[model samples]
Target: MNGLEKKQDQRRRFLRTLYDATGGRRLTFILAPDIGTKLGLTQEEYTSTTDYLVGRGWMKWETLEGKASITPAGVDEAERLIAADAPQPERRNIPAPVIAEISRAFDATYTHAQIDNIFMEASAPGAPPEGSKLRKVAAWLHRINADSEVDALDIFGRLVREFLARPRWGTDLDPHAAEAYDEEDSRFLDALAAHGLSYHDGKIFGAGLLAPSKTLAELIRARDLTAIGKEFERAADKIASKSLGPLWKVVQRHLGIAPTPELDEDLKRVLGGLASIVAGVGAFRTHAGDAHGRGPGAPSIEPRHTRLAVHAAHTVVTFILETWKGSK
Candidate 1:
């Protein structure tokens, strides 16, 4: 290379070695000949380069015996240069099955280009020519997990759920009264039965509330979230078409509830929060609950979710029973 290029390379190397020796701390040292020799430079070249670097504000040259140390800025520049010079990590030409697994976990179909783009961003943690989204995601998932071993797509699923709950991230999710609830074998049945939905210990688990059974034992039992969710869908459909009058026109007609005559409050918390979300409950049951055509994106439900569904059913059912009894 030309003299100028050679000099530039030498200066970059000098900063790098200084950075390494000090560990990014301001390590003071005399301008020793050996330090220069390590970089294949004579004492004169080393001392001169140090002076030039000091002038560049990459490091501090102290007064005591011309002691030198790298500045924080020098370390950043050294790292930047080193990162730029580092060889690119060999890109993996991802296979189809791998891509399909990721696509299924995310509940979306992906094109080759989309996968390439996400992988390109997610692959290396700023080590690649382009930066990375995957490494950031990986770090986040790792932080959240203390012991669980998981795949890249599994991590992606968790992140989606996490973002789906946060206010900033879940704006699209828009917590409606519906779709608000969970899972286990013996995990949530008692909770389910307590709400008077449906649960059989061993047999006929996960059936939605098909008939208006008085107790959980009488109802078609549910074993899983999907089964319980089906019951909610049935109840919502009945209420919407029946005198319950959907989410919008309820309460005043049947439950003796209406807007306050003074302030004109529509009683949104009960009507808006609880009743309105019923729609989402039906939708959630259809999409992620134990319904058919669940497809690949159905999130595994937690027990808490099942409680929400069962409770909603209880609220509606209790209201229906109470109204029916009063009339009789």
Candidate 2:
């Protein structure tokens, strides 16, 4: 090659070598002799090249006692030069099989909303600064899609288990441990612990998992669906019994329920079920002792039985929601 070409090549090689040495670490020191030996150049050539780099505004030098250290700008130039010559490959689209595995694993332990939020956080940059676990999971998913050989479910399951088992790194009461926690972090250290589930951390340290508040919220919301379903059933019952009929009737009239055959059929079914329940209760009262054997008073409802009935209704509503809405 020509002298100009050779000079350019030398500069490129020098920058690439510097970039490789730094990797992800901050602050690298290079002695003149070491650079000379690596580049197979004499001490004078090394000194001249170093001067050339400084002249080009790519590097600056500092002397501390006898050793020389490169400035931050020098590191940046090295990285930039290396990156310009060897650009990183574009991130590949995540494969369908990997997405399926993630979906299955998430669904088994968490609600649809939780999984959805987790992905949303993963897709959005700066959305979950505190959720290292979520970041890990997103990384793993990307790796799995890239070329990871392990089973996605097993890997993801291991990660989830680990997340459940470990005390969150930041929440430890020890002063040294607490120092690691970022301020305004919303992620919890113990989520499933509040719900009575436990796991081990050692088995899943390498598995990518994220434990952002979004994921936790999704899980909690799924649990709340059961409560909401119960409330809905109780409200339905009260309305059917005319206890809250006026309110429901007003809603029905406003919504033009009578004009829709499907609405009419559903309403009929609800009223019929209530009538059957009342009839059954009345039949039981008739079989009990009358004025001669019992005191003159109305039949008393058992609070425990009412509570159990409410629970059963709630469970039924929850089942319907799960089957139809595919949530909770």
| Per-structure clash totals for the candidates | 19, 6
User: Clash pairs of candidate 2?
Assistant: 133-209, 133-210, 134-210, 134-211, 137-208, 137-209
TM-score of each: 0.30, 0.25
In angstroms, the error of model 1 at 318 is 60
lDDT of 2 by residue, 1-328 (tens): 9977867766666655655655524466555356557888666666677677668765456554323444566677776775686866543333444444433444444444554465443332223223344444455465555543444433443445432433445465677655533221112223323322222321221111223333444644766567756646755655546433343443344333323456567676764454344444444445432423445474544434333444444443343344434432
Q: Please list the Cα RMSD from the true structure of every candidate, rounded to 1 decimal place.
A: 20.0, 25.8
Best by lDDT: 1
